[model samples]
Each structure stands twice: as C-alpha cells, then as structure tokens.
Target: MTTITAGRLREAAELLGIRNQATLNEIRARYSERVKEWHPDVSQNDPAESHEMTIRLKEAYDLLTDYCMNRPVSFRLEDLEKDLEQSPADYWMERFGDDPIWG
Candidate 1:
C-alpha cells in the first residue's frame, strides 16, 4: 500500500467540511451529519452540493480510515480486515500490517 500523506488527508477533511483534526468518533458524527444534510434526497434544493458532498464524503472517509489504521502500535492484520469490512472506505488494511514505523 502507498504511504498516506498528511497533506492528502487534510485535503480530504477540507473537502468533507471538516475544519480541524478530530477523533474517530468526531469524524463519524460529523460525517453522518453532513451526509444527512447533503444527501440528494434531503438536499433536493441543492443538487450541486449534494453531488459534491458525496465525493467529499468518500474522500474524507478514506483519509480517516487510513489515518486511524496506521496509528495503533499493536495493530493486528485481522483487525485491519475487520475494519475494512466494517468500513471499507475508511478501513485501510494495507497500512496497518506494513512497516514497524510508518514514518
């Protein structure tokens, strides 16, 4: 798997309407709220933002998943797969079982 750059992750957050670094719970809560608000069904009045929000949501999720999986020092390979299955976009199994130090 490729290394995840902080710049790319930050960019994803910005696209997802996230203005600051956040915990996993914070990311999930905020992402859900934004998705609900911008869902095409909910935001019929603004199709443009809705479409953009969809793409942004995916990016944000991927970045958050990658970041999270790459953190824990004792991360496990099976856990990575579980994470991916539970939240594929944010799972990032590849990064977890790689080098001892991602840096």
Candidate 2:
C-alpha cells in the first residue's frame, strides 16, 4: 500500500489549482478544465509538455478522488474484486438475508 503524505496531498491540490476544502464537484471541474488546456490533442504547443501536464493532472484527480471517497490513494478495483470473490457465498447470503429486496 502506498502512503499519502500531507505533502503529496498539497502537491496534488496545487497541481489541480484547488484547496483541500474543495468539493468533489469542484475538483472534477478543475480537473476537466486543466485537462482541456493541457491535452495533447487540444494544445498546439510542446507535445512533451502537454503530455506531461496531462499525466500530472490525471494523477492529481485520482489522488483527490480517492481522498474524497475515503479510500486509500493506492486502492485498486481489482483488489476489491479479488476480496469479494474470496468471500464465501454464505457471507452475501447473510448480509442480504434480512433485506426484503433480496427476497
């Protein structure tokens, strides 16, 4: 698992041009705007710089998304899928047993 330090969070916020207090919607908006400005296809300037900036922007968006979702910054969907697959069928049965929707 990767540790997300305050410095890393700060750097991500800076890259996205946002504050820690920014909401998920705000972060998404900023990320979209930045991506549009730096995307290689959209930007006519240095392709290398545009590519680099786009990468950084994506990283920043991912980090902030994880934080806002209360998930580890390095969390992966594959890991969750693996864990779910390993769980016994009885686990889900028990979890949803009382739900009328599952009846």
Candidate 3:
C-alpha cells in the first residue's frame, strides 16, 4: 500500500485553500476554480507559470480525491443528525470523558 503521509495531506489541503474537514463536492468545486484560474490557455499568467500552477492544482486535487475515496463515509439520517447535534460541550466531553473533572 502507498503511504499517505500527514504532511502530504496537509500540503494538498493548503494548496486547495480548504480546511481538513471539507466535503468531496467542496474539494471538486475548489479544484475547478483553481484549474480555471491557472490553466495554461486560460490564465493571464505566463504560460509556463500557468502550466506549473495547473500541475500543482491537479496534484492537490488528486491527492485529496484519492484520500477521500479510501475513507469511509456515512450518509444515514441518524448519523447526519448525530454529527449536527454535537455541541462544543459534547465534543469536549467525548475527548475528556474518562477524566474525573471533565466527566
């Protein structure tokens, strides 16, 4: 199996200007916007610069897409609702649940 290092994932996210929690559609949209901006034939930048940016954008998009594709996702209503229902308190409680003070 190919290793997907955290640094590579972080670099991809940074290139696409997305947070770590972005959805697939968001990634796609961002990639499309970036490609349109830097495509060699379309950009105002010098062709070589545009080509370089386009390559970087493609690499970032591919890395994110492949990573996301391999990860599991749940789309059930209950799961969705459960995520939405989590408050700041719930998040902290989950992390510190076994501690005496936090519990």
RMSD of each: 12.4, 11.7, 6.9
User: What is residue 9's positional error in candidate 2, in angstroms?
Assistant: 0.6
Clashing pairs in 3: none
Q: Pick the candidate with the highest TM-score.
A: 3
- For lDDT, the strongest prediction is 3
Per-residue accuracy of model 2 over 49-90 as CA lDDT, tens digit each: 999999999998998888789955544898878666756667
Q: Global lDDT of each model?
A: 0.73, 0.86, 0.90
For each candidate in turn, the TM-score is: 0.56, 0.64, 0.70
| lDDT by residue (tens digit), candidate 3, 1-103 | 5589899989999998896568899999999998998899989999999999999999899999999998887999999998889897888677789899867
lDDT of 3: 0.90
Instruction: For model 3, give the 10-residue run with minimal summed lDDT.
Output: 88-97
| Model 1 Cα shift for residue 66 (angstroms) | 2.2
| Residue 90 displacement (Å), model 3 | 10
Q: Candidate 1: global Cα-lDDT?
A: 0.73
Better of 1 and 2 by TM-score: 2
TM-score computed on alpha carbons, candidate 2: 0.64
